[model samples]
Target: MPSSSRSFDIAVVGAGICGLAHALAAARKGKRVVVIDRDAQANGASVRNFGFITVTGQQEGECWNRALRSRDIWAELSERAGIPILQRGLLTIARRPEARLVLEEFLATEMGRDCKLVEPSALSAYGDGLNGAAFAGALYSPHEVRVESREAIPLLAAYLEEQLGVTFLRQTVVHTAAPPRLDTNRGLIEAETIVVCPGDDFHTLHPERIAAYGLTRCKLHMMRARPARYDEKLPPVMSDLGLVRYLGYAERPAAAALRRRLEAEQGDQLANGIHLIVVRSADGSLVIGDSHHYAETPDPFAPESVDRLILDEYAEVFAGPLPEVSERWIGTYASAPDRLMLIDCPCDALRIVLITSGTGASTAFAIAEEVIGELYG
Candidate 1:
């Protein structure tokens, strides 16, 4: 069997970004923190994502505020953890006048304090090769940052282990998680407090408590493509379909009209939950994605038809020939019916935290800070 006795002040189960965030929070408090995960390396939605710490386009209220705090934490970690901030803003293009109307209403909100609308003529100033003349307008928000998630996740774990003095117990499964003691496949673990950050597999740990919330799984398709030449100055891009998906934009009253237009023209894409969020990587290739499909147990299949839908939207927003597709993969994350995230108090010493939305990268750190504060204070 593995080592029998290891104890800590806080034991964070799952080493994905959410668990790492909790580890960082507890470690920052000088608590003896140990993170346990079933995988030896980073995997799952945390690493299989765009790594965009987005502050704009988050549902207003707590989610938007948390994104702001989390974005700041990511910025600090860029230096402290040696992870690069690959891209640092968002450029959302409105392809229709209805979509442009939505952007106008969005800019009037408190959430749009620093963002501005770019006229079609000025869109080229941001970068080249965009189909600017075809766009109704664009919204520029200097509030998002992107990293290669595959690289950043592992580096964040290293920073916690090497710099923050946090301990990692990998390839270990905990069968039972009750604070002060845990029964694992490896051995026994002891911690004064426990935080379970199971990414999408709810039945594995605290299944009973998790089931009470009626959580499901969300499957998405993402790809990387090699463009012959991409504009280095262009920020990450999102298109009109995102208006009906991202709650921050969809919540705007004007979005109702845009949604109707999209329903008539792109019903197939909408049926498959397709939206466009294209971010750039350090290698000059582009990372494009992502269509959402939800189920109690999401299917593993990724149809090329879904990919074609995504590429069609990409074509509408860009001016050049399509980039050569390089890599593609599927990802799944825990999802809720009515909420973006939840922290369930199974008991006094244990908390079950899950980011039910895709906003884990954008909001996990701030949520971690809140959990740690309440537990210790």
Candidate 2:
């Protein structure tokens, strides 16, 4: 049925981080904005990701600059929205000699200035009872920040509505027919501009459009820890594993020799889909993971073998005993064959953006700025 409705300056589909970022950008411009999502609760990669607003491992050039800018935006929003900033820095453990060498070289570049290499003796000041064998030393980056995503997303949604006057249509499914009309369970919504931020549900919305970009699904396994039994003095952290995966670090001449060595040493683990990232919650409990597996259809079940592989790496990094697991889950996100993000205009006025590189929390704000500028400018 044809319906009567009010119009908005811009209609953003998907209330995840990307859509929220777009809504925030449009509202800051004083444009009337409405966000539509199929779920009554906003749950997806936006909430499922590590919530680590990372700057250290971002591919150099445009990606790194965007992450740096988004970090600034996150700081501002966390204050205005009254969301808690869980941690203020990043501690990247380097267990392998080759990994330590990589950090040595990475610090020589302009991107590495915000960080410093610290020996194990200095680590005692941050936390107690670390596993001695986990790392000889680690790189500490002062530029990153972390928030509890499960809590942060809801807080951001409320802030957008209460503070920014942005409207939200929840539990609504939008069909991208002519003029991009949304047929919600509530009613029909017609808008001039539509921006889709489908995280992993690419097939549900616009599979054909995304398929041309070689977009495939990538799955990660993660576990949440029970609150720490001891004091909470450590900062948000990741393993030096990414230094080998991200070309920005691997491509450096100084890092190349070390990269080749670690690859050869850990070749079996890499082939079996194992990597490590250990982040902590506000109460001191740690969230550790994960492994990467690419498939057309990713299983939601968290395999025990994969979980063990992640834990084995953890055992190698820390000398102390491993934390008892509290909860485990799998997260899937759209990834492009190319290492960069994909933002394409399927129509003159319709924009589809995917964070094909798992950098949504890190880079979404800057990406939204570019999208809105092109549309409203």
Candidate 3:
């Protein structure tokens, strides 16, 4: 059916996870929703990510709580949509004594209530191939879940359109979005409410409004590898690099000491914003990444040095020969210095939402529920 002639209760711009989340929220509320995006398929950060629905390492308070809620939604939706939950839980390795203190401190907090501290010798109980001798301890949190992003995005969209009856308009450029009517290259799309989830293209819908937040773009490197030997039992792996990157551990008082040690020992990794998050697919291939470099307009280049730094951290945690790098790519997301996300209101009927902290997979569903509750309730 042509969407131009039909009026919907809501129209969501963008087909990424954020947009799909809004579509699901509105449709569940019995709203006739149409989602419009410029791309013909799910691309951008949504598909390029590791699809890790992280809950344990998010910043404390709102971000952490939102992640918890979002993880539950992912579990529910995955089962309903027949999407595979490839892995569960997290292993945040503590590679130094200071890092161990940070994890111990984290375990004492409300966010870490359900998490436990894993000693070096006992770490293998969680999974094999962990370089335990290189670590002080580890933090195990059973709050995370992993999916193959490339596959799950399309599956989630299909479930929304087929089971929930949400309309999707791909390859449709929305020129002007001002609620009631979204002026698009295809045709005008009418709706009572509109939610725009522009991933990293801040200049598109409301440039001036988005500009007020001082948002920048963060470019990251990603890789797909086949390790010589990998334990299927291992949860997704992170390391000391993540303690400084993930706020749940970083914000603890003990993190200052850990950061100092990291600066002394891994300055290059810190300078490059390199962190380790290795998750596996059902086929035994690993999705690994990422380093953060922020700029208003990030370059399209994926440098070998950046990838080398990522692999350096990977080698310290996982044993056996280096994995065969089968594929590589780059991903970019919106970044704000002081906030994890933003919900900008241009009018009573329109909202512009962006996950500035690259946490869409971790927090999109919960954020969408909040927006929909405010818009409809």
The top-ranked prediction according to lDDT is 1
Candidate 1 collision pairs: none
Determine the backbone clash count of candidate 1: 0
Q: Which ranges of candidate 2 are over 4 A from the true structure?
A: 1-5, 132-134, 177-180, 227-231, 254-260
Instruction: Quantify all predictions' global Cα lDDT against the true fold.
Output: 0.94, 0.79, 0.93
Candidate 1 weakest lDDT stretch, 10 residues? 1-10
From the highest lDDT down, the ranking of the candidates is: 1, 3, 2
Q: Please give each candidate's TM-score.
A: 0.99, 0.93, 0.99
Which residue runs does candidate 3 get wrong by more than 4 Å?
A: 2-5
| Of candidates 3 and 2, the better by TM-score | 3
Candidate 1 C-alpha lDDT tens digits along 348-377: 999999999999999999999999999999
What lDDT does model 2 reach?
Answer: 0.79
Question: At residue 298, what lDDT does model 2 achieve?
Answer: 83
Instruction: Give a tens-digit lDDT track for model 2, residues 1-377.
Output: 22443467778889999999999998998988889898997888888888989888788888989999999999999999988888877777777676677777778888898789988778877666555445767888898888888898899999999999998988888766224465556676777777888777777667788888877888989898764353466776556566666665666664666666657776665765666777778777888877888987887777788888788777776555677898898888888887568887878778888898778998999999989988889
lDDT of 3 by residue, 223-244 (tens): 9999988999999999999999
Score candidate 1 by TM-score against the native: 0.99
Q: Candidate 2, residue 235: CA error in Å?
A: 1.5
* Candidate 2 TM-score over all chains jointly: 0.93
